[model samples]
Target chain A: MERTPPHPEVSAFDLQLVLEALVDPVRRSIVTQLAVTGEDRACGTFDLPVSKSTATHHFKVLREAGLIRQYYVGTSRMNALRRTDMDQAFPGLLDALTTPRAVAR
Target chain B: MERTPPHPEVSAFDLQLVLEALVDPVRRSIVTQLAVTGEDRACGTFDLPVSKSTATHHFKVLREAGLIRQYYVGTSRMNALRRTDMDQAFPGLLDALTTPRAVAR
Candidate 1:
């Protein structure tokens, strides 16, 4: 069985933490992909240029920040953007942040 | 004579830098205050608990991120939220981010 890392509850999402997690170009890319897909993607699916360790760190940051949720599925850790939670927490934020042209580096 | 530090042009506003600047609680507070006032405010006029140097650092971050504009007026460095630029760059971002309860730490 795959172990799931701890994540913050939607109600406990910290704005600062979320923003910090999304500030990085790589992390923002991850979030943008997830938002665009609108479906949970396996950890290995992202075409991140960073090493495995760095990619793991970015996922951890996003999970801890309550911006993404991770769950195990047949030994694969799948990640999805917590769009509903984000929308509820800060109206229009998810849409603005996920705008491809705006966030694209 | 007061000197205004250089800031990014509106067209050059970058999402990563803007989000990074707003991720800090103190910086968010400064932006929030400026948004609420809807007018330019002197740096010293903010009731920040941090030391002058620290506050200055935060202001610099905001300015460099293109989230705020700072201008010199009679030796006072007045700061104002770059609402127009932000709105044009990332529609609805400033309003969502400046919502008091949402970004309040």
Candidate 2:
């Protein structure tokens, strides 16, 4: 049996961990992709700049931080952004994260 | 001459750098204090758990990330949250940062 990795409860999400996970550009990109699509995506489909192991690490960080939810669909891992949960836990966080970056002068 | 340290232009603010600076608890606390008080504060007035050198480093990071502006007042260094600048550059970023920390769970 393929065990689902444990995820932190949304109510218990730590701001530090979420910020730490989001501090990585690759991880932020992953999140941006999900937010842009508004759909669950497969682990292998997103455009990641890092190697396989590195992508795995980023997904793990996102999952543990409760920023994303992952589940297995056959052999492919699907990831969905935990938008509502995160917003409930930390208001405006996803809005901040998903907004267009560095636009003003 | 007590020259003011360089601050990144709001037009050039980088989300990656901002997230990196904000990931630390001490740095976030400094930001929180300014946001909560809505006034400039002397460097020595903040309740930081770190050493003087460490606190100085945190302030430097926050200022460089364009999250705060620092100026000298008499013999003391005063820090002010760059709320307007940040709001213009990265909407919702400060709102998320200033909101209560980890209160959901």
Poorly placed runs, candidate 1 (over 4 Å)? none
Instruction: For residues A1-105, write the lDDT of model 1, one tens digit per residue.
Output: 238778787778888787888788889889989988898999899989899889989999999998899998887889988888888887888888888768664
TM-score of each: 0.91, 0.93
Cα-based lDDT at residue B99, candidate 1:
83
Give the winner by TM-score.
2
Query: In model 2, what is the error at residue A59, expressed in angstroms?
Result: 0.5
Question: What range of 10 consecutive residues in model 1 chain B has the weakest lDDT sum?
Answer: B96-105
Question: How far off is residue A23 in model 2, in Å?
Answer: 0.7
**Can you write out model 2's per-residue Cα lDDT over B1-105, one digit (the tens) per residue?**
448789889778887778888888889888888988899999999999989999988999999899999999898999999999988878888888787664222
**lDDT at position A97, candidate 2:** 76
Model 2 over residues A1-105: C-alpha lDDT tens digits?
456989888767888888888888889889889998999999999998889998998999999999999999989999999999988888887887787663211
Q: Which clashing pairs does model 1 show?
A: none
Task: Give me the overall lDDT of model 1.
Answer: 0.86
Worst 10 residues of 1 chain A by lDDT: A1-10
Q: Is the docking of candidate 1 incorrect, acceptable, medium or high quality?
A: medium
